[model samples]
Target chain A: DAGVTQSPTHLIKTRGQQVTLRCSPKSGHDTVSWYQQALGQGPQFIFQYYEEEERQRGNFPDRFSGHQFPNYSSELNVNALLLGDSALYLCASSLVAVSGNTIYFGEGSWLTVV
Target chain B: AQSVAQPEDQVNVAEGNPLTVKCTYSVSGNPYLFWYVQYPNRGLQFLLKYITGDNLVKGSYGFEAEFNKSQTSFHLKKPSALVSDSALYFCAVRESLEDFQKLVFGTGTRLLVSP
Candidate 1:
């Protein structure tokens, strides 16, 4: 089974621009989560989506938003991107029952905000 | 609040030698600890976890972590290090009281296994 798949392996955007990253969950998984990892830092939780609704969120600002389609695919959108937003955006998926416990991650999309 | 700490920035070891990556955690209620390894340009791969059971938990890639309650530590260990085992290691903790299931991760430790 294809684990988690992310699109646009790498992206470059200027400050104030917006970008959208995509993810496809692994087979038989229903929950999707996003994380941001800065250089030399561990991954930080951004938000989680289940049943097409956001179940939990981290300390991120409103500019960072996401949506999970019925097909279990997810999209992470960042509006008015800041240079500080440049980092590796990771997508993780797991069964809803596992919830906040066990999850698998994708390779991640590297976002470079200039 | 839950937090994890990987005190060492890097660890150097020769092949065939045993390796240990130290991890300490702080959490309120029962702690769910986890270890993940990340290779260059790759996502983090689950290594092992300590939920409830024996203090010695074995995980993927021949890795095992010992959970010590007194020390509040869960150190990752391998019997014999291999050159291919070099990568970035992360320790994470999840507090049972927290609803988000969010994991607070450590800064990460880089392991270098020289052949």
Candidate 2:
């Protein structure tokens, strides 16, 4: 019963570059969501993916995008990265059901935009 | 728009003393409230959530929260604090009527339990 897992636990990228963060949802989970946690602040929602389609998105710019595979794994891509993009990217997974479900999160990938 | 508010930036309490972290929210419809704890350099860990029934919800790590509909508040509480309980606590809200649940988080409150 492994929980949500994220890849590239820590990475660095230069300005104007691109980065992709990967996430594997918890066992028996289907929906995947991404969040950005800046220094000294709580996480802000980026977007959510279900059935291989983006269902809802936050106020992020077009530079931020995501993909969900059939296996419920997800990838978050950020293009033209800026220094402000440097933060902890968290991946959360939950079940899409009528009732409220707990969203489990991964340790997150630390992105350092240089 | 739905939003969450954690008024205190930081809270300190002596070990073995009771502790409380306050939270308030605003949403057009019914809200699904949640509390999460984050350690340094770690991701958010789910503590508890208030969905429908039971205004008082008990969660992991000896934490509990009481939902007050009239005040739109859900304050996290613990009967006795521990040094290890020190961490950043966040309050989040999601509207029940929303088709896709996306949590709106507060600015977060740092809790320090001193010996």
Fnat for every candidate: 0.54, 0.64
Docking class of 2: medium
lDDT of 2 by residue, B1-115 (tens): 8899999999999999999999999999998999999999998899999999999999999999999999999999999999999999999998873445589999999999999
Off by over 4 Å in 2: B97-99
Encode model 2's per-residue lDDT on A4-114: one tens digit a residue. Answer: 999999999999999999999999999999999999988999999999999999999999999999999999999999999999999999988747899889999999999
Q: Chain A TM-score for each candidate, in the given order?
A: 0.96, 0.98
Worst 10 residues of 2 chain A by lDDT: A95-104
lDDT scores of the candidates, listed in order: 0.91, 0.95
**Predicted candidate 1 versus true structure: per-residue lDDT over A1-114, tens digit per residue:** 899999999989999999999999999998888999999999999998988999889999999999999898999999999999999999988886663457788999999999
State the displacement of the C-alpha of residue A69, model 1, in Å, after optimal TM-score superposition: 0.8
* Best-performing candidate as measured by lDDT: 2
CAPRI tier of model 1? medium
